[model samples]
Target: METRELRYFVAVAEELHFGRAAQRLGMAQPPLSRAIQRLERRLGVTLFDRTNRTIALTEAGTVLLREGRAALDAVAAAERRTRRAVPGRPGLVLVTKAGATGELLSKLLDAYAAEPGAATVDVLLCQPGEQERLLRDGRADVALLHRPFDSTTGLEAEELYTEGQAAVLPAAHPLTDRPHLRTADVAALPGLPLPRWPGPGGTYPPGPGPEVRDHAQLLQLIALGRASAILPDSCRSHLDPGLAAVPVLDAAPVTTVIAWPPHSRSLPLAALIRIALRLGSEHGSAALVRGG
Candidate 1:
């Protein structure tokens, strides 16, 4: 009927003697005997055949012994799994941006995997808008967001690095001859192509535009001299023979931030946040040098 009763039943069943079962359980013989009597009463079955000199299991006792051992084993296994999921143990969720941030997140996650008690990180590649909702709803443990978070109350964000934008152009384009170009320079180019904005209510600044969904297509258009697009410097490293990147002048830097629910500041999550910030900062700095 209860775990304690089942444990008592198991000890008595194993030892086949009330006196020895009481000693094994570290309890008095009278209490142990009464507990087994209550267990038999709850089940409406006789568990033991007892005489003045002998004690042995009845048919019901044999069945109960088998089922009771299985039930106790299951409870033990469940407790083991619960302990493993505790704070300071390994297990984490990372919600991230689509492009460069995603790459950075992957590297940090791999490093955490090698550490002792490191959490199994579930990385969710998400859009900027979904971060607040994910954190609020408990779908994610931490998020890497492009800065200027819309909501700040339920979350804590730490600025990791600032990323500058660059112009992607066809290698032979006239602008490619210059070491870098400004927004005005690209805006002034004749028939300059730009990717279509994909965000909700997304619209690019007034200009000649090509409706493109992702960065790869934007690169393809640049390669064909059909258009030029502006993106973070980290994207510049992905250039091919036909495509080149020129730095954008006087553009605001997009800051990448590490964010987590304010309530989840446990030791393990805090440790993971530190790792993410350090790695992201290092990567952003490296990208700047390489792109430059």
Candidate 2:
């Protein structure tokens, strides 16, 4: 009946565990259970068969679950359309990664703020999976990410620039003596402390070697001879004292890209894209000057 009840039912149906679903929704299990019960009573059909050991969706429940998701999507799309049509306000939310994209966004926001009739920009620092989820759910209007994206459908992507990955090492490490260190050299090092690999959403992947949450922690770890990390050139700007960033040998450069739901090509988004292109051009010019 109510949207909230339908949402709870759908979450439980998808997760198949009331406890886990409640946790994901940030609510108590009892309340989620109550909402599901209310929905079931209204529909006169049991959506789930639950016992102490297991939870499974019934046939009727499956049909309703599919329909419920579609209905929710339609409602969300409608809301996005209505919001965009409102006067004197920017209706888009931009989500991007924390390092270079974050910096680029700040510059764009400054320009936008100076313009008349600029839309509101909500710049969210999102994890890899979060961007996909936000775009899919109509919660985010645009996203910028380091490639490779897991999925391409329902979105449009533009390449911004290629970024080299650097191996961040301790100052006292032998590799620091060189201007650049190869990936093989790193992999061959005995007892080298390597930072944990980042997952699809830019968070440290599960399981561990060494995990550093920020540039300072990364520097501290490397300085103590505890570990090394491979990071993009953009991240180099964040390096702390006593850390050396050497180029990784023979590694493929990562690409930075801007992505958005295919339908979000508003005037503001176009302007932002132009700004990004200009910044990329400027960076290229600077790189050429340094090389020369």
Q: For each candidate, what TM-score against the reference?
A: 0.59, 0.69
- Tens-place lDDT per residue, model 1, 64-126, is 999998787656644543564675555666776555465677677887777687767787765
Which regions of candidate 2 fall more than 4 Å away from where they truly are?
1-9, 15-86, 114-116, 127-129, 149-152, 188-192, 197-207, 212-216
State in Å the error of residue 41, model 2. 18
Task: Give the number of the best model, judged by TM-score.
Answer: 2
Model 1 steric clash pairs: 90-118, 90-119, 91-119, 91-120, 193-227
- Determine which window of 10 residues in candidate 2 has minimal summed lDDT: 96-105
Native-referenced Cα lDDT, model 2: 0.73
For model 2, residues 1-292, the per-residue Cα lDDT tens digits are 6667768888998899999999989999998888888788888998899899999999999998998897788578658656666666656688765444555677768876776766778877754446666666777777776675445565687777776778887667777778787888876666665667466546676644686554456567777777777777666666666777888867677777777767654898787777777776666566557536
